[model samples]
Target: MYCAELGISYEIVPTKFDEVKKRPFTDINPNGRCPGAIIQYIIEQYDTEKTLTYNTLQERHHLKQWLQFQMSG
Candidate 1:
Protein backbone atom coordinates (compact mmCIF):
# COMPACT_ATOMS: atom_id res chain seq x y z
CA MET A 1 0.00 0.00 0.00
CA TYR A 2 2.76 2.43 0.93
CA CYS A 3 4.73 1.57 -2.19
CA ALA A 4 1.66 2.08 -4.34
CA GLU A 5 0.93 5.38 -2.64
CA LEU A 6 4.53 6.44 -3.26
CA GLY A 7 4.13 5.64 -6.95
CA ILE A 8 7.12 3.33 -6.69
CA SER A 9 6.83 0.53 -9.17
CA TYR A 10 7.65 -2.93 -7.85
CA GLU A 11 7.50 -6.51 -8.95
CA ILE A 12 5.90 -9.34 -7.01
CA VAL A 13 8.62 -11.91 -7.27
CA PRO A 14 7.26 -15.06 -5.72
CA THR A 15 9.84 -17.20 -4.03
CA LYS A 16 9.81 -20.27 -1.88
CA PHE A 17 9.65 -19.64 1.85
CA ASP A 18 12.91 -21.47 2.35
CA GLU A 19 14.69 -19.36 -0.25
CA VAL A 20 14.34 -16.25 1.90
CA LYS A 21 17.10 -17.52 4.19
CA LYS A 22 19.52 -17.62 1.30
CA ARG A 23 21.74 -15.30 -0.72
CA PRO A 24 20.35 -12.61 -3.03
CA PHE A 25 17.47 -11.47 -0.88
CA THR A 26 19.71 -11.43 2.15
CA ASP A 27 22.26 -9.49 0.12
CA ILE A 28 19.66 -6.78 -0.32
CA ASN A 29 17.99 -7.08 3.06
CA PRO A 30 19.98 -8.53 5.93
CA ASN A 31 16.85 -9.83 7.63
CA GLY A 32 13.53 -10.78 6.14
CA ARG A 33 11.53 -9.49 9.08
CA CYS A 34 12.87 -5.96 8.68
CA PRO A 35 10.67 -5.15 5.73
CA GLY A 36 10.29 -1.58 6.84
CA ALA A 37 14.03 -1.17 6.63
CA ILE A 38 14.04 -2.61 3.13
CA ILE A 39 11.34 -0.17 2.06
CA GLN A 40 13.31 2.70 3.51
CA TYR A 41 16.39 1.54 1.67
CA ILE A 42 14.43 1.44 -1.54
CA ILE A 43 13.26 4.98 -0.95
CA GLU A 44 16.78 6.13 -0.30
CA GLN A 45 18.19 4.43 -3.35
CA TYR A 46 15.44 4.94 -5.91
CA ASP A 47 13.15 7.60 -4.49
CA THR A 48 15.78 10.14 -5.52
CA GLU A 49 13.13 12.74 -6.28
CA LYS A 50 12.17 12.66 -2.59
CA THR A 51 8.55 11.92 -3.40
CA LEU A 52 8.15 8.98 -1.04
CA THR A 53 10.29 10.63 1.61
CA TYR A 54 12.17 13.78 2.39
CA ASN A 55 15.91 14.40 2.78
CA THR A 56 15.86 15.74 6.30
CA LEU A 57 17.98 14.08 8.96
CA GLN A 58 15.52 14.41 11.83
CA GLU A 59 12.55 13.35 9.75
CA ARG A 60 14.37 10.29 8.45
CA HIS A 61 15.45 9.31 11.95
CA HIS A 62 11.93 9.68 13.27
CA LEU A 63 10.55 7.57 10.48
CA LYS A 64 13.20 4.92 11.06
CA GLN A 65 12.41 4.96 14.75
CA TRP A 66 8.75 4.47 14.01
CA LEU A 67 9.48 1.60 11.70
CA GLN A 68 11.72 0.00 14.32
CA PHE A 69 9.02 0.38 16.95
CA GLN A 70 6.48 -1.31 14.73
CA MET A 71 8.86 -4.22 14.06
CA SER A 72 9.77 -4.61 17.72
CA GLY A 73 6.44 -6.19 18.45
Candidate 2:
Protein backbone atom coordinates (compact mmCIF):
# COMPACT_ATOMS: atom_id res chain seq x y z
CA MET A 1 0.00 0.00 0.00
CA TYR A 2 2.75 2.47 0.84
CA CYS A 3 4.62 1.56 -2.33
CA ALA A 4 1.39 1.77 -4.26
CA GLU A 5 0.64 5.21 -2.83
CA LEU A 6 4.14 6.30 -3.81
CA GLY A 7 3.69 4.93 -7.34
CA ILE A 8 6.74 2.71 -7.01
CA SER A 9 7.02 -0.36 -9.13
CA TYR A 10 6.92 -3.39 -6.91
CA GLU A 11 6.46 -7.13 -7.22
CA ILE A 12 4.99 -9.60 -4.77
CA VAL A 13 6.59 -13.01 -5.01
CA PRO A 14 4.30 -15.68 -3.70
CA THR A 15 5.75 -18.65 -1.91
CA LYS A 16 4.63 -21.95 -0.50
CA PHE A 17 5.50 -22.94 3.06
CA ASP A 18 7.99 -25.51 1.78
CA GLU A 19 9.63 -23.02 -0.55
CA VAL A 20 9.92 -20.43 2.19
CA LYS A 21 11.81 -22.95 4.29
CA LYS A 22 14.41 -23.55 1.58
CA ARG A 23 17.40 -21.70 0.09
CA PRO A 24 17.42 -18.18 -1.43
CA PHE A 25 14.37 -17.30 0.65
CA THR A 26 16.24 -18.55 3.68
CA ASP A 27 19.19 -16.47 2.53
CA ILE A 28 17.00 -13.37 2.63
CA ASN A 29 15.41 -14.28 5.96
CA PRO A 30 17.46 -16.53 8.10
CA ASN A 31 14.75 -16.58 10.75
CA GLY A 32 12.23 -17.73 8.15
CA ARG A 33 9.61 -15.36 9.47
CA CYS A 34 7.18 -13.36 7.42
CA PRO A 35 5.71 -9.82 7.32
CA GLY A 36 7.63 -7.82 9.94
CA ALA A 37 11.15 -8.98 9.10
CA ILE A 38 10.30 -9.13 5.44
CA ILE A 39 8.78 -5.68 5.46
CA GLN A 40 11.81 -4.21 7.21
CA TYR A 41 14.14 -5.94 4.79
CA ILE A 42 12.19 -4.69 1.80
CA ILE A 43 12.09 -1.12 3.03
CA GLU A 44 15.77 -1.01 3.88
CA GLN A 45 16.79 -2.65 0.63
CA TYR A 46 14.31 -1.43 -1.96
CA ASP A 47 12.82 1.80 -0.69
CA THR A 48 15.48 3.83 -2.50
CA GLU A 49 13.18 6.88 -2.62
CA LYS A 50 12.39 6.55 1.11
CA THR A 51 8.76 7.03 0.19
CA LEU A 52 7.01 5.63 3.29
CA THR A 53 9.89 6.48 5.60
CA TYR A 54 11.36 9.63 7.11
CA ASN A 55 13.71 11.74 5.00
CA THR A 56 15.34 13.99 7.63
CA LEU A 57 17.32 13.08 10.71
CA GLN A 58 14.75 14.64 13.01
CA GLU A 59 11.99 12.71 11.30
CA ARG A 60 14.04 9.56 11.62
CA HIS A 61 14.39 10.13 15.36
CA HIS A 62 10.68 10.74 15.65
CA LEU A 63 9.92 7.54 13.79
CA LYS A 64 12.23 5.65 16.14
CA GLN A 65 10.46 7.19 19.10
CA TRP A 66 7.09 6.17 17.74
CA LEU A 67 8.28 2.64 17.13
CA GLN A 68 9.66 2.50 20.65
CA PHE A 69 6.36 3.71 22.02
CA GLN A 70 4.51 1.02 20.13
CA MET A 71 6.91 -1.62 21.30
CA SER A 72 6.71 -0.50 24.95
CA GLY A 73 3.04 0.27 25.21
lDDT of each: 0.73, 0.66
Model 1 lDDT per residue over 10-55, tens place = 7877788778667887887666444676777777777777776767
Residue range 10-49, candidate 2, lDDT tens digits: 8987788778667887898775544354445656776787
Q: In model 2, which runs have C-alpha deviations exceeding 4 angstroms?
A: 1-40
TM accuracy, model 1? 0.55
**Candidate with best TM-score:** 1
RMSD of each: 3.8, 5.3
TM-score of each: 0.55, 0.42
